[model samples]
Target: MCGIAGYIDYTGKAGDTELKKMTDALSYRGPDASGQEVFSLNNATLGLGHRRLSIIDLSPLGKQPMFTPDRSLSIIFNGEIYNYREIREELSAKGHAFISGSDTEVILHAYQQWGDECVKKFTGMFAFAIFDEEKQELFLSRDRAGVKPLYYYQHNGCFLFASELKAFFTYPGFEKAIDPQAFRLYVQYTFVPAPYTIFKHTWKLEPGCSMRVDLKSGNIAQQRYWDVLDYYGQPKQKIGDAEAKEALRQRLIKACEYRMVSDVPVGMFLSGGYDSSLVTALLQSGRSEKIKTFTIGFTDAKYNEAQHAAKVAAHLGTDHHELYCSFDDAKAIIPELPECYDEPFADSSAIPTMLVSRFARKQVTVALSADGGDELFAGYERHAALLGIAAKKDKIPAALRPLAATVLRNTPKTVLNKIFSGNTSADNLAKYLDFLQGKTDLADMIDFANQTAAPDTLAGLFTQAASPGVLFRKNEIRKLPGRLDQLLAFDYLSYLPGDILTKVDRATMHISLEGREPLLDHSLIEWIATLPDEMKYRNGVSKYLLRQIVHDYLPREIMERPKMGFSIPLVNWFRSDLRPLFDEHLSEKSLAAHGLLDHKQVAKLLHEYYSGDNYRFTLLWTLLMFQLWYKKWMQ
Candidate 1:
């Protein structure tokens, strides 16, 4: 894994100075070594810079801007190619020779032999840019799940790209103007969605995509190399439940086995959740030596999961390490979030993820995260709630459904909250009603369910129109019959990559730690996506089949417990340990200076929180995160 930065200056004004700064800014992402290169041709300059973490080959030969023997193609890559050894053996048989035992060299040869087709053959997370000197082109590609991030900024004919958004700020001419639409979107979604960044001209390259930029003509061609829908859109599983379970077990073992390839020490982030527990079980089953496991806990009982993690670790006989953080330790990390994320991100779980990554980094260079399991296998409470609402909504006539939805939307949020105080079903009702306003369907409902701020809330903040979320723009889940499939597909396409993966990537990368997700292996995802929805969730239980598989290695008593997320006590902290930050960030002066939020609405949110309706935490955190980011970047 590494960090890459580069620029293609159409006017030849770009040089090594800016390239050095861009690459240097990302040194935290790759603390092992660094390199920079520049080429001038056709009144244009092409520069590539890399910060190497040195996972595969520890020697100097693994240094990048890696190139083929002829030096016609050079690549700056960030991520592991888990199947590189297999690909290397294939290349060697085809008369291709490699100089070092490195995945970077394998990628260079793969590109040399197969051209753009090389990306389709890769099975691991990656975001890379390759410069083809002979063709005078720059090829960029992100892995299928967007496990890695690639951000780019284009203005005045200068194109710059980096692994993190902050690298763009290193360019002297780069503008700091915020994209207003994207800003409002960030407030609503808690993270800027793909194809849009905080800045107008900057963009996030979507997952499973590749682009070829003609250096001479400056024409860019972009396309998707793979799609999860291609597999999920197929008919449901024809095999029996037992067969599906066995198939899943084998695929997971293979994925974990391949991800274990590295020259550095590796470990697992064992949250004691179904996903992480399963990963740990598979990893420990075959090995004689214990694998390292790390978990982060809180002093407060409600927010801590370390006990469960410890129990799981003891049962598995692994080397478990944990840190129970005080509220002050978490609060101390708050000020650095603006720099740590380099974008507006408000997922509260990032706190624990950050602490856990730091804890693991002390012992291991690479750690596996169980991120995609929830989205793949219907593991969230919201999924079950949405399905239940869909069933009831199906009973309503299509003609009258819109009117009923309008009535629900017209109801005051405060009135609903008052009547259903702390009732999860009522919250689901509100979400379903909000979803019903515009489009009364499974796909539209899925989009509405993920919002942190409603349209009325956004309108009160922004001067211009805040367009509806881009999620329901099209029905990509045509073959997904029930609510579960549609919700899964939406979360996979939107939430998983946009918010969840983004949170994990930023947190882990900030500490120069590599995080792998075995559960997210495309092979396993495709296999699970094709299975029946009941296999994933049944009898009011999420991940039912997953639980059965996990039971083989763990006792039923240990595996059966209420689902607890790696979440922090945000509302309590906001009112206590972080009260000063909350007051300062949302004070009238701060609100007035920011000018993107309505003072009255902000006051109302504050009232709700102080009056014991702590449910406003999500919206409050969303505003605080956006406000913090605005001052740090836009100002």
Candidate 2:
């Protein structure tokens, strides 16, 4: 992976100093090397710069702002193409000569052979900008699932594109206004979705899409090349347990093998969970080399998974490294959050993710992650709960439905939490779902926002529930095998790419390390979508098929342990080491200065939580992240 930045100075010539500043700002993304290329078509108006991470080919020949043989196309790219070698061989037979062993060169040749259709031929994550010298157009594309990020700004017929939003600040004319609508969405969703960033003029290129800007006409066009909705209408197929398990095994092995193509050393973030263990086990089965693995443990035993990671590393006989994180480490990293995310991101797991990536980067340049497992398989507890709730709601008699809804509304949240804490899977699922559904009045939560955002903000909750993929149409007579399958599909479209992938991408890229997710392989995801839901979740267990496949390579003890997610001791930290810093950053005066929040309401949340009247850790964290982000980017 690498960092790419450039600008189309349609109003004037982009000088050397401007290009240097843009490229220099992104040096962390590609510490290996850097390159720049300027074109003076239409009176010296377009320039592109790239920072190289040097993963595929360490040779100088692979360095970019690489050009086609005919010199008609010049490109800057960030990401890896797992199928580059296969595509290169095909192009060579067709008389395309290659001067380097890098995937960037393969993309240059592929664009030459297929034109804009080249994106369809690619099967990896990427975000690239290609300047067509002859056509006088700048073409930009992001990968199918947005594994790579591309941010851009357009003002007065000039467009600047880069790997991170911070790069846009290099230009003197860039403004720092916060986009109010984006802030509203961020508060509702905990993330600002694509096509919208925190800044008003800046935007992220949506995944599986492309854009082209014509210099002559000063016009831009955006279009979608792929989407999950395309596959939504297809009929679900059934497979026996034995057949499904074997198919998943083969697909995962192939996915891992494809991602293993790299000139530099490759290791994994082995958290000792089912997801990472499965990837590590597959890599160990085929390779003769000692696979290097890294994990981070917290001082709090309840939050640490390092011991489990070490056990898996020992079983596989691979080189292993472990880092223990303390409350001080979490405090130290808090100040760096604004710079790392470049926007308001409330996922506190980003701290551990960054720690593991930094530790792994010390040992290897590329790291494999098992990120897509929960979304692809029926893993998260929410999926099972949503299914059960839908089933129960459907069975309620029409006459009593309104009364039941009223009763659910009147049920105190604390009482519901108590009722849902039993050992039974169904009870646990119900409790979690009830909490998420936030069945209680929004008046309480609304008071937590800066000010009560518009009532429309709560509409997002309904939109998520009634989203196109989440709920089937009432009249449609489709027979899905179970609720688990539906939940898996929903998460694959939303949570996986939106939250989990975003967390890993930002963390790893911050350290200039390339992190690849093999479990998110498109072929494997599509195949798994066809399997019966029971093959995924059986007897209240998650990742059932994955555990079975892992059993073939490692002992059952390692595969069957209790599930432990990558989490930090936030509740403890809030009451201790982070308290002072948190208070300073989220002071009521600081928030009121932004003029976006109600200081009184914000104070109530902080006061109630600190006094032990409520445990509003997640909500408070989200508010703290936004406050820090505002201080960095807006104020």
Candidate 3:
């Protein structure tokens, strides 16, 4: 619910002036108040800036860059600590005194009480920086699931950290060069995974991790404090279906109730999908007052879910609001993409997410989202696909597998598209077929499932292309027991934070609305991870266990609909409303000016896309996003 920016300057050039500019850029994230302070260290000048969104405490006492009573430690934080009251009680029992009800104050005391291990006690989404005045050290930590963003830069004896990349632009002597490997990663995954950003000498502090900077010696070290893998690797809980459902129901209620601990008005985004509906149902069941719910409807029926959301809202008797938008409304948001997402993010669904957040912000200051459900439970179609591929690939005749792969590789994309009937793109089919050519293992299945672009194809597009390490962490991932469990663990590690969580954070914070993910409570995920695989997904149904609990609150007919994920009509838009933007940003002149991508290859790709190669839409969109981001930040 805030924006934090700070730097450790050995050269002594950065101070309140630089801090103000950096924080000023993040005003939309926290417009209630702003704070900036400079601490003179033994060998460096530490500057911290904050933009307050005032979710937990609306009083002046909640203002940050808050300091300890003795002024030995000061901190700037950018998230909510849902369990602060519980932690406060624990700290108070330890003789720690508190003057304010703000979670920021609780964090300061928690750090004092437990030192580096304090993060282990927190149960919330947070990205914070604490400067130990006496120790002359800066400590930074991000929440376990990375629900909040924290980007940092380190080079030439200087260290800078911020909630958003835009703040880094305000720092003096900061370089803007793109990291070649990260660019390739973005091209391959349509998102650059953490521990890597688009720029060199900078990184997103990986989730469940913390860093300590030694101001005196200018040394920095990072360590992982928590990981979901440990839970996944544990033996399955020897619990029955009824017991598991009851246990999950209790945890779900607690998680939802915890997120309702804000001073400001709160609401939920009810997408009519299993995840959102379940969150809305659980929260509304516990309250006498109707919870405010918001949903975005598309005029295009194929992509619309507002009607279903209205049904869920009515069933729960909550206040409901829906915005039905046209292609024009969605297209208008295209130009703002670069500003909404500081990084080059290619999730087309982000457009609708931002629209919904903007809509919800009109009446509520905080909104609860059900994002981590898909990763925590087996809710994704790809999860089923991974399991299905592993179980069925061996059924194919060993001698004819190569022949089938050859036929698929040589088939015309248009023909393949017709055969698949647009259920999936020919590009993905091609990748699957290629995987079939080899001896399919769990690792190979995962690699194929995640392949966005083949390495050879990416090499042809960029002048300097190298594979990112995240793409092939297959060996480590295969250690998990079940195929579904392994895929879920991999996603929770990479895709959950890299794409889904990032989209929600930026889209919500862009308008100063605090977006909370209730489904991502670490304790809930850890317990769910120990359940048997069939309990999560069974008989061709995903989120089977979660659905059973949801059924207890609502009828089966109302909640048994297909999962139509939040998405946009990107291909049709490119053919009509977005054609001009595609031309303007991906123009040969623009590509030549960027001097990173091969203009000739881009031209060829565009030719193919316009010539009915619709599978290439994702690649084209990724390139367009990168081009737009480059113009906005790098130019």
lDDT of each: 0.85, 0.76, 0.87
lDDT of 1: 0.85
lDDT of 3 by residue, 1-635 (tens): 99999888898787889889989989999999999998877778889999999998799999989999899999999999999999999999999999898999999999998999999999999999998988888999999999999999998767989999999898886788888889888877888888899999999999999999999998899999998888988999999999999999999999999999989999999999889999999999968999999999998888999999999999999999999988878888888999988889999999999999999999999999999888887787778776765565577787899887788778887876564433345456655676677744666656555546555566788887465654534667788867887888888887889999999999999999999999999999899999998898888888889999889888998988878989978887787767887888888899886688998888887888888877677888999999989888878
Q: Which candidate is the best by lDDT?
A: 3
Model 1 worst lDDT run, 10 consecutive residues: 417-426
**Best model per TM-score:** 3
Put down candidate 2 lDDT per residue, 445-474, tens digits, no spaces.
Answer: 212221122233333312123121111111
Query: Which regions of candidate 2 fall more than 4 Å away from where they truly are?
Result: 412-415, 418-486, 613-615
Clashing pairs in 1: none
What ranking emerges by lDDT with the best candidate at the front? Answer: 3, 1, 2
Model 2, residue 570: displacement in angstroms?
Answer: 1.6
| lDDT head-to-head 2 vs 3, winner | 3
Tell me how candidate 3 scores on lDDT.
0.87
Kindly state the number of residue pairs that clash in model 1. 0
Please list the Cα RMSD from the true structure of every candidate, rounded to 1 decimal place: 2.6, 5.1, 2.1
lDDT per residue for candidate 1 within 99-190, as digits (tens), equals 89989889889988898999988989999999999889999999999999999888887889999988989887688777878887787788
In model 3, pairs of residues that clash are none
